[model samples]
Target: MHILHLPPEVISITCQGLEYRDLVRLRATCRALTGPATDAIRVKAWTVPMYSDCVMYKVRAIGEEEPIFQGYSFKKHFQHHFPQWLEGNLVEVQLLMSLAQEDKEDGLLALKQLTSKLENTHVHVKVVGDYSVDKNEFKQLVEIVATSPPNMTFGIKIYMNGAIGDFFIPDKVTRLCICYCRSIGDFPQFSPTSRCQVHLEIRGGDTDQVLDLFHNACQNSRNLSLAKVTVTVIPLTDPLMSRLETLEFDSVMLVGCLRSTPIPPTKGITCKSMKKLVASNFEEFSYFTSPSLRRVSFVFTDRWSREGNFIGLQRLKKALERCPSLTKVKIQAREHHLGSAETGDYWSDFFNCFEHLEDLEVVIIYSESPITGDCLDTDIIFLGKALPRLHTFCAIDDFGNSYVL
Candidate 1:
């Protein structure tokens, strides 16, 4: 069989399955195969790494004006060229650049050029870096993105630099994520009328500043449906309590006023929209009075300061009594014996607090002496029958074993 007699379409299709590096070799085989193989090469260019390490390749058409690279070289090599085989359909355009101080000029220029190209097309931009962009650069970037159509989704990860204030929030962004930022003051304002759905995770900050930011943002937001809001707070506030749909507070200490304010019978500040809540300190549990709440997760750490114990189990019991709509509840107790015969009585009393709960997940980390088998069995039986609405029961040991409930 003379392979040379094969149709061009047949040859091109056959080469489609070859790896990118191997395709280059096949293209060099003969002039006849080169044309089809070149087309194949273009087709594979779409899958090339768009965002890697700290470098972002700002791509554009071949004849378009060349982007200024400053001192850095912009290789005009064919390897970086757009493949002709691509159907000219614009999908997502990702721009990556190292935020190194030396690379600042080139990075800014690349950003400018990329923004200009994006102005004419419906391409989503994902900017990933740890460096701090100046206020002027960040403002320009935000203006370009905000003015774009609302359908475009933009993702940006600016590493922890005290400079988050420089980046102004773009109004049209549909989804946003901020990680490892130094403070929440740099976060954008969320208006109730704003169309964006936000996911914010603040890993580091002074607790008061974090809570202040959360309260301010929630108050300004017209629609309170955030995808999720997770923060570590030293103290919790009532204002930040009412707005979130899904809330996670870790390493929080129940400080300030603990006087049991009678939970308003009408359901305090109805977070009819809340679906999930995770609190590490029971003293801070007073904030979960939403009638629309679906899930509640409690984590009791052994590392709790003296202030945490001051809030006491009584306050926690009253807080749970008010959450009538809670469907799932998870309790993670650390450094607390929750299954001793004495603790069994405490468990029986505590389980009675969540009368309306349907699904229960409990993790007890015993200290010193291991949990006795009889004590564990007694607590499991008490919880299973105590909550009449309960359907699924999970009792995890210190090692994360699920004992039958």
Candidate 2:
């Protein structure tokens, strides 16, 4: 059958794989194809952000592998999709935009229109822009987002890659992430009534200042996550560390850190309120303990090397024993050769550590490479004998296949 003989729905489905240029080409081919081409052009786009190059914006629609739309100011390119764009069925949307360059004003104007009625939907707006110059415009955007009915879980996150000028964090700001800030200058006034989660990526020069900022944020943010932040010594002795209920650190450099010192006299750094931890350098964290800790996840890019050099494993085992409330654990490793099961059931014995706990989950993920070990010292075996209350256990095999243990 000729292509045009097919129904319009079939033609629309075929257009999904075609690029915008291809769609335009299809539209130019004949008048009959125009309707279908336009329909395909509107593929699943609920919100249109007037895109710019001086800054990048990512409106991450949930479950989408690629962006819904990219390039061209929304006013120019997406006007055709406005009818589809006006669909009030928007359930969840995430819009990320950078306001660094000259085009910010135009982009913000377009964005304000796109987000006007988004108060009823689950909205998360990520602003990677300068706040000082467009202070009023920035606050207006937050006001639009924060006015959501009490049923919605709305969030506004500001990303700072440079210095913070004279500014104040709106009480509506939920999560604030600052990266490599040179000088904080006039510290932003945070409302004592509001709580905001903070993530800081610090540089070697700004280490002391950022650490102080981290501690100050603890009053409002009980959940703190740090990435690539340097510390000459563990600040466990600092009273603020104890107030943290959720602490996450991602530092690949801690694997071979030489300045590692005993965490004071307690044999390990202890957080009375810490309930969950996610760290990349498990070796350095062996000396960390929490009585209320319930879940811990370890992701490493290092190899186990040999059975004799399991200092990280030994220390973590002791640390796990100290946490009487630990119930769920996840270990994800990549590019690391955890050696074969030549020695014993040491890998299986690692699960034995949880034998004392009730209701537990153990997840072990390994790199599926020749150098990487496929099994955990023992071939896949149900850990039911070791963990009677094993809630969920997932592990990979020799072929990198995952199966329940």
lDDT per residue, candidate 2, 231-332, as tens digits? 333343443233332445432122223233335435346655556666545644554576766777766444543555654455556666777677777766
Residue 115 Cα positional deviation in candidate 1, in Å, after optimal superposition: 20
Clashing pairs in 2: none
What 10-residue stretch in candidate 1 is worst by lDDT? 44-53
In lDDT terms, how accurate is model 1? 0.47
Model 2 CA deviation exceeding 4 Å by range: 1-119, 128-165, 180-184, 205-266, 299-313, 333-344, 367-391, 397-403
Best candidate (score: TM-score): 2
Local distance difference test scores for all models = 0.47, 0.49
68 in model 2: Cα distance from truth in Å?
20
Scored against the true structure, residue 157 in model 1 reaches a CA lDDT of 49
TM-score of model number 1: 0.43
Off by over 4 Å in 1: 1-172, 178-194, 199-231, 237-272, 301-316, 337-353, 358-391, 399-401
